[model samples]
Target chain A: MDLTFTERENAFRAECRAWLERHVPKESLGSGDTREGFARHLEWERELFDAGWAAVSWPKEYGGREASLFEWLIFEEEYYRAGAPNRVTQNGIFLLAPTLFEFGTEEQKARILRPMARGDVTWGQGWSEPNAGSDLASLRSTARRVEGGWLLSGQKTWCTRGAFCDMAYGLFRTDPAQKRHHGLTYFMFPLHGEGVTVRGVDRLDGDEGFAELFLDELFVPDRDVIGEVNQGWYVAMATTSSERGLTLRSPGRFMATASRLVDLYGRYRASAEPALRDAVIDAWIDAEAYRWYTFQTVTHMVDGQDVGASSSLNKVFWSEMDVRTHETALALIGDRLELDIDHDAPESAGDAVDEGAWMRGFEFALAGPIYAGTNEIQRNIIAERVLGLPRK
Target chain B: MRFAFTEDQLLLRDTVRGLLARECPPDVVRSAWEARSGRAPSVWAKLAEAGVTAMTLSEASGGLGMDELDLALVLEEAGYAGLPDPLVETVAVGAPLLEAVGTAAQKERWLDAAAAGDALIAVGFEGQPFVPHAAVAAVALLHRGGDLYAVPREELPLEPQVSVDRSRPIARVDYAPDARHRVDAGDRAALDAAVGVAFDRAAWATSCVLLGLTRRMLDLAVQYAKDREQFGKPIGAQQAIKHHLATALIRQELARPLVYRAAWSLAHRDSVRDHGAHVSMAKVHAANAARHVAKTALQVHGAIGYTIEHDLHLFQKRAWALAAMYGDVGFHRARVGAATLPD
Candidate 1:
């Protein structure tokens, strides 16, 4: 029931706040939502790491503070409250770091962990091929055995941040004879390796966050293999599990956004139509729900309960909330929303913040039900696993 | 800050769940539902004996010094069991209001008795569309002109009517000029604070009850879908049944954390203004979810569910009543939108 930080934890929060205040450039605020702007976000993450605060959940030996999960939660609250960054390195910090800590060898950890934690290297996911998105087990990516390494060849579409990353961790078909989830291997391949071409995909907003990767015999040494060969499905599942189930979304950051939106509505209240007001309220409620939901997750973590299928619910809830909120904002702005105004709320009687963010947000919201498994997928998980219903 | 419950709370949940399994089984709940008064005094007395009535009250007030989250678990379990009682009114609103805003004399006179399950307290907000189960309440608290009051049911205009859920009675109670208890306190600032806390607790607990009922409805539907068959195949094997149940499951799951988190926040008094939004979200999701689950369950059960002899309508009726109880999804969703996205 209690959501307050302990005295020591409050102190930790203060420390985090102080560090963010010093390192996060003032220009960084409200600067994300675009590829180049996101690059600046990566730079801020580097500063956070240099200040000894980035990825606090990682082991200290791997350039982390090795803090408890509760402390990590606190770090997230304070980090977002300070408006630090939008977490451009989320793939590395949230998904890969945990995998490396648990299953990778010490050498693998030593080689991959530090630079990634330091934000010096950005990594993209090479899991989804053109034909293997929903049925990921049907991936045809190949990694053939060789004297010094393995040769990988496949095309990975929908590679978020693929165009900006220097390296990628992939699940390739290491065993060509087998099919359907088995015979796969996890490999870490350099984005700049021979015969690799990454072409950015322009989103509706005219910005590129995803890319299509063409791999022509990319070489991945044996040392780069993660976990056992042909066991990448399980390893990949572990990554997906932690990403969906374990990690806590930054509640305070969204609250700040809500607060700002409130301010925005007030400034334009005279011009806001009644229907827009209604839309605004709908968006606000979704945001509030997210904060409370995260608090519940924090409670479960405090109680040492694994969130399990409950976490699946959150993935759907928060993502949809984000879309709804932005949509409301866009509607309130009217025709003015069509222009690009990223700095501050524009006074031009248009959507000063650009309708594109809202349009982009709506498109992205559709992905919520799609990614990390669709909402339908999560529903089945709940009915079968949590409710003990028959799968049929 | 940890948003999770302490180990003690987890253990408390386990204890309450186990107790309900034994005493509040489906048959027991069915009988309680069929009763004319909507609830049995003896059954309520047993709940009080189990300390369910006083779990969230201070020890000084002859009860446990548990927080709202702990009480939420109790409310949730009661809802899950479909126990016909005003547990939220008595516990969430009455006890906590007495603790936070009640004078020493008021606590001694009302809260202590309420904690002991002697003085059952309920609230009638905006009076007219009275909440089901308010007629039999010992005391009905209300909010008028930002002032909290405790008015006698006899003094107010109360018209008792049969509710959809026969287990809970509803009365359209109107306020009389001379019937209100003037809760004289400090200035406007302090009064709003006190009323706000009570509202948050009440709203959150209501949402929890709805969540419990919604989860139960989904469970019943899923179970029926598995057992009920048509044309030599289980109904659940059909895509229509699966999709219907799937949607219900979606709404139920979405409602859970919203209700739980709202309870958690109120118990801790974190972000006071946002409590209403959380409560609204929880209610919106739960109300809609419960109704869908109940309807789908009944539909899946065919003619069996429509009979007065069957228990399926009991849950369905409660869901229908609750959907309007805390403001419908549209009301709350709009409330949430305004509160969080005010600009």
Candidate 2:
């Protein structure tokens, strides 16, 4: 077993490092989650896509470089290290794209993948209804079979990027007769379609990254169905796996942030209290461990190995790690931590980079533990499914 | 770039696991604790017959020359079994240290016997003077100011000291300054490198063993949870108990990759610079996993785990002792911190 990268991997690292160095923006895009900042973030996505750097893990035929998993990880590390803008199309690029590649029709692949890859259309996930957060199977959204299409009716809450995304894919109970994971279908429908209405969850920043969907007979053609009818459970499970697995939070993101945390520590190293120092150190250790752990996981995936239960384990671990890291960064900054800013802050309104990026990041990281699936649910998965314990 | 073990190494782990399950079950560990020797001779013989002791020894030293990863896998199984020998210290740390730095004659004298399973070898890092199993072992590896020495058992007087882990007989090796055979390990730089490799490998093995022990505790606790009923049902059904085991599983899963990767880095040797840092990281993470798992496992098992009548203490004690071996949590964490800082 070897830990060091091969010459080819090192070369890929060099290429990615060079590209990110050349293309990363000269100024911070205020807050990528905000409505005003998304255009610039989209521009960054176009820049990366134009350079053939975006979606490096997708097959080359699908507008990616067909890079190895390790190489893709290298790309992520370089992407985060260069302080590049966040991927505005993450939900589409990371989640829907992979699921589509796996289960999409040739026509579906032909029509959707390129635009998704090019950031022409953004996709938001439509899981987690008002009645269903952790108990996701309790969702009451329905899709009725029609002569020409399926008519969707119900509400989906916590739709990330819903206010802005062009489309969403979610599970709907196709047969009201069958309950609890049966007779359901996965379908993709446009948010701007005729019968759809969306209201952004009001926030101080007005970014409206998450929204609530109200559907009344939203028409989605049968061609928009993902996988078999009544098999949305399996398909949605795959999507959740993507949400938890390496696709969403790669080790590079943690490593890059952790490195920044270490640099921040160097700034406060002189008068830093031991408790603060330890928190900083804990952040670094966990981040480093996560990085190495991802490498091991990549090796396994590349060898066609399965990492069952570890997917949930990874979600719990890295999400919590992300929160701890951001918290430590905030604490280490001392009084600088007080500058909690929204986009309209005086500094944010100008050409200058706004401060409180860590604070913003810390606040956003709170969603990591809660979203995708809560840690409580993940722990249950580990206990019953992985450990062979009796189900509650 | 494979992080998983090869078939051969995996088979070695399985073989040892199967043998230990049959030969050295918890009952053997319990009985061995009460016995005077406490070494569990039959189980040691079975491990030796399986060639577990000779894994890290070089072919030139009358033994198979597997790398650190191979030996680490075997040691992990031994740990999972909670075997009471100094086998981890013997094969992973002691043999490898002598092979790397010992004089040809020094290896011929010490390595052959250790590999043959006719004798056990115990190691004493300078700071932690307790060489486990030193009492009835054939030899002792003791370190002083700047030199690492392999003194015969007859040369040094052993003062027996009881530890919380009854099966592991700890001792204070009473060695005077002028009394030992100095195995020539070149200059200060060479000696330091040898010592560093030995200590790090030992620490890495100790962490792997601790991980194994913690997993055993987790397994035992989970089984008991399924069997022992409370509240008119199996307590395992309770969210409190499920969450307990779940958190333990998380800690183990998280620490596992670090342990294996550190083993890989150590096995890779010259291919990686400053590999000791990974070893320390593994030690620190594994120690934390062990601590969390043991405490939670005991809580899940309730009163039964608190008694010596049950076998939970066997693994719990070994985990706590092994965490303190080489260096404890704070020491290794500080080492990692020091490694991180820019010099």
Off by over 4 Å in 2: A203-207, A345-355, B103-105
Best by DockQ: 2
Candidate 2 lDDT by residue in tens digits, B112-141: 888978877788878886878888777777
Report model 2's interface C-alpha RMSD after superposition on the true interface residues: 1.5
Worst 10 residues of 1 chain B by lDDT: B176-185
Using alpha carbons, what is the TM-score of model 2? 0.96
Clashing pairs in 2: none
Give the number of the best model, judged by lDDT: 2
Give the per-residue Cα lDDT of candidate 2 at B295: 97
lDDT of 1: 0.72
Q: TM-score of every model?
A: 0.85, 0.96
Model 1, span A163-243: residue lDDT tens: 788888879988888887889998888888578999888765555778889998888889999999999988887787666
Write the residue-wise lDDT of candidate 1 on B127-243 in tens digits.
337755567776677777666767655555677888767778777766653423655456768868777667666666777787777777777778887888777877776666665
When candidate 2 is compared with the true two-chain complex, its DockQ is 0.65
